[model samples]
Target: MLEVKDLHAFYGKSHVLQGVSLSVGRGEIVALLGRNGAGRSTTVKAIMGLVSAQGSVRFKNEEILGLKAHEVARKGIGYVPEDRAIFPDLTVRQNLVLGIKDPRKRGRWSVEEVFSLFPLLAERAETAGGVLSGGEQQMLTLCRTMMGDPDLVLIDEPTEGLAPKAVEQVGEFLTAVKKRGISALLVEQKLSISLQISERLYLMGHGKIVFQGTPGDLRANEGVRKEWLEV
Candidate 1:
């Protein structure tokens, strides 16, 4: 339910996104794949209005390009950055509470529901976020964001820096999110994990989308993979 059209973004003259266009339909998982400096993360940030952007961004068929970040979030979008910015000083419960909306809306999710998705967070409810391990912090950050009850989530590098098993857990978690009818715009470098969780993939190069297809189609297109994604 999100559409970005010919989006251009920059960081004070260093243009990072050039005519980037993509769409995530309802209950669909779309992976945005590219190497470093390909502007995948910038695409998400621009959609959130975290950076100035040119072009059209529509969420639920409403124009959202110029809205503030919170305004965008209020329109049923959640973002989990690669850094997993958990509040170090806050307890796990506190961090989760921060994502909770007041006077919860009809379609909103609750803390208990989020904990059900990440039970480890429930066990560490009282622990200080700073003292948690990297995997735990990542889980906490994701759980915190889920508490927002978003219609669509933009996740950046959910598997980065984690152990192999943790990466698998992230994969399963994303799969669960998909089954729950949550749409995702995933930006990931780990192709295998991303393919496992996504139905469609978009390969980007030099700040633009070069290929868009099913994961299986991408696997079969050795030529496109070599030209746009090979290291």
Candidate 2:
């Protein structure tokens, strides 16, 4: 439901995304695999109007390249940054409440459903969001975005820092997102998790997509993995 074509973004004349192109279909999980500085994050941010970009960012068959960030979000596209952004002062429940633009405009997610998915959140519903651990904060961020009820989400490194259990929780969370009929463009460094969950993967290098194929195709291409994926 999201398509980015020849997207190029700039940071004060320093070009980051060099003719990047990709797409995420309805209910499909597409992983953008790359190392730091590969422009994977820029691809998503540019699509969301967070960066100075010139290209075609189409959502649900409508072009949204030059729209403001909030305008882009209003069109049913949510973004979860690499560094978990949670309210420091608000309670967990209150933070989630802020995600809902309109309580009456119930889309696909609810507070109860989010709490059910992460009981820790339910237990700490009244607790201050800033006091939670890194993993808990990650869960909170993802849940809050779900509360917005977007059709597609751009998640940047959801498991960047966490214990194995929390990592697994994130995996389960993505599965639940798909179950709710939401697609995602996942920007991640972990190949194992992406390979396990994503139907297709795109590897970026030097600010460009170097490989695009299914999990099986990616797994079989050892050269591509070595050059673009391996540490």
Candidate 3:
């Protein structure tokens, strides 16, 4: 469903993503794994048009490299950044309402349905988003993105600082997304979760994809893991 070829991105002459290439099939979850500076997040930002990029980014066979971020989003892609960007003063429900692409048309997900996925959101529906716990904020961001009815989502560090239980909840969220036939490009640090949930994984090093294979293949290749993944 998504393909990136020779993608390059920069931050004021510091090239962060250099010739990165990968693909995500329909209804498939692909994990991008690497150390802190391996350029995983830059890859997604380039695809989303949040950064200036040069190369080919195609979703469903159409080039989307130069489109603006909002334009790319209208093309059925959602992004959940690592920072958990949510409106601090808005009520949880109100924040969710803002994610609706069109109020007149019903999409694949609803506020009530997302509330079902994370009951705490329903309980805190009227609470200010700034006051929620870190985990709750993360959940709210994920559900709010889903509220747009995206065909694919680019999630960056969904489990970064959460407790174990919250991490498990993230796993559940990914499973739910997969069950609904949504594609995901997951940038994650937890190797265990990535190996458990991803059908395929790509290991990045020095701003390029160094390995691409199944979980089993990654498991069997100790040298690749030690070089590109293990700390």
Candidate 4:
């Protein structure tokens, strides 16, 4: 459903993505793994047009490179950044309401449904987002994006710094997304969770994809893991 070819992105003179290429099929979870400075995050940002990029990005057979970020989102792509960007001043419910692309048409997910999925969020539906705990904020960010009913979600570092329980909840959330037939390109540092959930994986190093294979294939090739993934 999503294809990126020869994608290049930059921060002024410093190039961050150097011809990165990858694809995510419908209903498939493809994990993008790498260490810091490997350009994993830049790859997604480029696809979303958050940064200036020169390359071919096709979603559902349509070219999307250089489109505005909101245009990309309207084309059925959702993004959840590593920072868990949420409106601190808004109530949890209000934050969720903002994610709906069109309230007139029902989407695959609803606030009530997601709140039921994560009762922690349901309990704090009226609470201000700034007052929520870190894990709670993460959940709110993810659920808010889900409220958009995207065909695919670009999630960066969902499990980073979360407690084990929160990490596990993130995994469950991915499973729920898959059950709803949503594909994702997950940029993550947590190999265990990625290996457990992803059908295929790509490892990036220096703005290039160094490895592309199944989870078992990734495990079999210890050299790639050692050189590109391990700390």
Candidate 5:
């Protein structure tokens, strides 16, 4: 559903992405795996037009590069940042309401649907976002993105900073989200978690994709893992 071809991005004079290219088929979960400073997040930023970039970014056969962030979001793309940017003062429901756009749908997202997916969030519907735990905040962020009814969601490190049990819950949540036929480009440090959920994997290093294969192929290829991902 999305294709990034020979993408190049820069922050000031420091070049980041160097001829980076990858693709995410419709209804598929693709992992963008790489160590820190490998330009994984920058690629997502460039695709969303959050940063200036040179090259082509096509989503659902339409060019996305050079469009504003909101414009990209309007074209059926949603982003859940690594930092989980929740509004500190807004109630859990209110924060979700802000992220729930795409008025073409029936009610965007019914409160029942959200609560069903995240029972914890349901119980804290009126609580301020600042008071929620990290795991709760993560669930809220993902639920808010889902409320937008996006075809593709770029998720950056959804399980980071969570306890083991919470991490397992996150993995389950992603699986459920994917079952809804939403394509996802997951940028994560935990290869095991990503492998459990993604159909394909793209191993990146030094701002370029060094390996692209199925999850099983990636798991068996210890040489590539050692050279790029092992730290």
Candidate 6:
């Protein structure tokens, strides 16, 4: 559903993504794994047109390399940034309402469906987003993105600072996403979750994809893991 080829992105004079290439098939969950400075987040940002990027970014065979962030989002791609970007003052329900691209048309996701998936969100429906816990904020961001009815989502560090229980919740969220036939490009640091949920995984090093294979393949390749993934 999504393909990136020879993608290079820069931050001022520093080149962060160097010829990075990867693909996500329809309804598949692909994980991108690496150390802190391996440029994994930059890859997703470039794809979302949030940075200065060059090369080819195609969704369903159409090039979207130069499109603006909002334009790219309108093309059925949603992004959940590493920093949970929720409106602090808005109520949970109000924040979700903003994610609706069109109120007149019903999309694949509904507020009720999101509430069903995460009951904690339902309990906090009328509460201000800023007062929620970190885990709750994360869940809210994910649900808000789903409200846009995206065909694919680029999620960066969904489990970065959460507790084990919250991490499990994120795993459940990903499973729900796949069950609904939504594609995901997950940038995650937790190898256990990535290996458990992702059909395929890509290991990045020095701003490039050094290994791309199935979870089993990654498990069997100790050398690759030690070099590119293990800290």
- Residues 160-209 of candidate 3 have per-residue lDDT tens digits of 99999989999999999999999999998789899998999998988889
**Cα error, candidate 6, residue 56 (Å):** 0.2
Global fold similarity of model 3 (TM-score): 0.98
Record all residue pairs in model 6 with backbone atoms less than 3 Å apart, i.e. clashing: none
True-structure RMSD, every candidate: 1.3, 0.9, 0.8, 0.6, 1.2, 0.8
With a 3 Å backbone cut-off (N, CA, C), the pairs that clash in candidate 4 are none
lDDT of 6 by residue, 1-231 (tens): 899999998888888899999999999999999999899999999999998799999999999999999999999999999999999999999999999888998999999989987899999999999999999999999999999999999999999999999898988999999999999999998799999999998999989999999999999999998988878
**What overall lDDT, based on C-alpha atoms, would model 2 receive against the true structure?**
0.91
For model 4, the stretches where C-alpha displacement exceeds 4 angstroms are none
Q: Order the numbered candidates by lDDT, best leading.
A: 4, 6, 3, 2, 5, 1
lDDT of 4 by residue, 1-231 (tens): 999999988888888888999999999999999999999999998888898899899999999998999999999999999999999999999999999999998999899998889999999999999999888999999999999999999999999999999998999999999888999999999899999999999999998999999999999998888888888
Clashing pairs in 5: none
Give the clash total for candidate 3.
Answer: 0
Q: Native-vs-model 4 lDDT? A: 0.94
lDDT winner between 4 and 5, please give it: 4
* Residue-wise C-alpha lDDT for candidate 1, range 96-147, written one tens digit per residue: 8888665455345667776776788889889899999888888888777887
Taken over the whole model, the C-alpha lDDT of each candidate is: 0.88, 0.91, 0.93, 0.94, 0.90, 0.94
Q: Tens-digit lDDT track for model 2 on 88-118?
A: 8999999999888678888688899888879
